[model samples]
Target: MAVHLFTEWSKSPGHLDHWERTGREQGEECGLPNLGQTCYLSAVLQCLYHTLPLTHYLISQAFKEDVVKRSPSRGQVVQAAADILTEMDRGKPKKGTLAYFKGVCGRMDDLFAGSGQREAHDLLSSFLTWVHQDLSSSRNACKKCGLEPERRSTISDIFEGIHRATIICPESGAIICSIHERFWSLSLPLNNPGETPLEDALQQYYHTRAIKWYCHYCRREHLCHRQMHILFLPKVLILHLNRYNIKGSDPKLNWVTFPTEELTLDGHLTPGQKGRPWSKFSLYSICNHHGNKKRGHYTACCRSNHPQHVQTPWLFFDDEEVRPIERFKNPRDAHILFYIGVSQVQQESRQTCLASGGMGLQ
Candidate 1:
């Protein structure tokens, strides 16, 4: 908690010039204009824009084919998304660029219902869900029974993860629950953000917690242990630190030192259940939130793959303003962290020096 978050308003002379120059060479550096309290929205989109594979898919309009195959009704949202991203890619970051995206989302029953301040994590999850539903092969069916065989989509293939929760009654030796589901992100607790480490938070996430429950088999209340397991890991991993406590007005402030290079989940996976056979990830993007829930600003620090700037392939995105970031390895107020498999990182770096895509702001 000794560390303080870096606000976007603070700046110095251009230092990561090499990285910025590389970004300009391989991709466009666009900034988003903040419309009212729309900084949260821009922050998340910026992170997604820098996601090379996603940019390639959406910009190429590959998702349209899936939309056609699935249903015509869903194409509207996908098309709007494509249009927004494409527009962002072709233009520079500035004010009034997010009209299309805002219009579309606003029309969706006034997305987020009505908002002055919105949660980035919620917006991200909702957007991904919409995209996944639009592209998925099936809308309803059993995933475990093979009833819906080809249910995957670009969104599912990239961001989705498989998790299984097992709960056992210690005294009765009977099961109270067993559930499995897909996850788009991992929400970690930050009760004491100042003192919590990234690894410690993760451990708490997968740790078994004891709960009192009535065991039907035992006909009495027993202390049950609930444990979560990772059956599969996604290509792009999103970790959202749960900093907002609705009961309180303020959000968590202290920063947690995370693994900027390589993060391994060798011990976290279910035994013999590594669906993707890859549990190692390397940090690539960060969505840092500054201030509290009432008034906060979001910024993104992304990894750039310019070979010449190997020592510093990182860029800071504050809406439409793009700059080189020398010290992105540890962001003090990183609310959400993005990571990709180490193997995939190597593959992407070799295949593409930079990726092109766009996002909206303000």
Candidate 2:
């Protein structure tokens, strides 16, 4: 849609008034996908108009056509556009809009470059927490899926839905979040940096210890597809897991699974269980394309979908200090939510930024 609009607009050599109507007609038929495409392109057009010093006719046409027509005039889309162009002098670029994009890109670059160090710092924090606490029970084993139950009972799980957890860029503190229940937890070691790099220490810890040397993707090593799996067990059983610090601000934890469409849980595990695990059992399903040659695919319960002993635990932030200003109770304390993260691509975009001169590595 953007390409089509750009092509048409670029060719139309008439006055702004003449082309404005044409673009509107085009956008009307474009549908929702086209609307998004136009908005993104409009942002770029906005940048180019200001920087390149286009003629007044061109600028006017772009705004009235791209900005005015596509904008819904009610929700955030139009409002934000209006806010950006608030101080728009006749025929000039909007100051607010330019500043907004520039700030976004600049901040993104800052985080991407410093991400490695920030992850290292987070590892230190995780290590300190692990060393300081003397857990009553260290191993809660689940024979079916080869996971430990003890680690699943941390504040991250206990207070799962209270307040949303944040998944910051670790480097820039820039945030990207998903729904609370979709977060994913991976185990990696921080204190004992035997082989893995300091930055990925925590991930390594999770892989080695929590996964029990099994591969989550292939399941050859008896590892579940994800480090964090929802298991069904009896209420009387208590889980013990290793505590790991969260990296971002988006209430959701980082984990993987395709959209719910191609994936689902078993009957017993279908209507997920809260505190009690044994009462009901559900099958955890995943669409994994990691090792397969056939693009990506979904991998469901080839084995058991229960928690294992000596598993990694989740950690939560948001005590009195991080709580919202409102007087309402923390949401995490009330609902039953899972911690999951977006896919690798989404996580990376939320995490890294690149600057012009140097290649930013995070």
Weakest ten-residue segment in model 2 by summed lDDT: 301-310
Q: lDDT for every model?
A: 0.66, 0.24
TM-scores vs. true structure, each candidate: 0.78, 0.17
lDDT, candidate 2, 63-161, per-residue tens: 333232321221223223333333232223344454453333224344312212122222222321221121112445544334334433221222121
- Residue 42, model 2: lDDT of 31
Residue lDDT tens for model 1, 1-362: 12211111101211111112212322355667777677788888878876655765787676767885344334665676677666666655434546556655666535554446687888888778777767877455534422334466778777877777778888766678777777889998776636577888889789998988778878788788888888667778899987775356245545577876558776677766653433467677889889887678888887654332234347788876789765445777789998865554443453353343221110
* For model 1, the run of ten residues with the poorest summed lDDT: 7-16
RMSD for each of the candidates: 9.6, 24.5
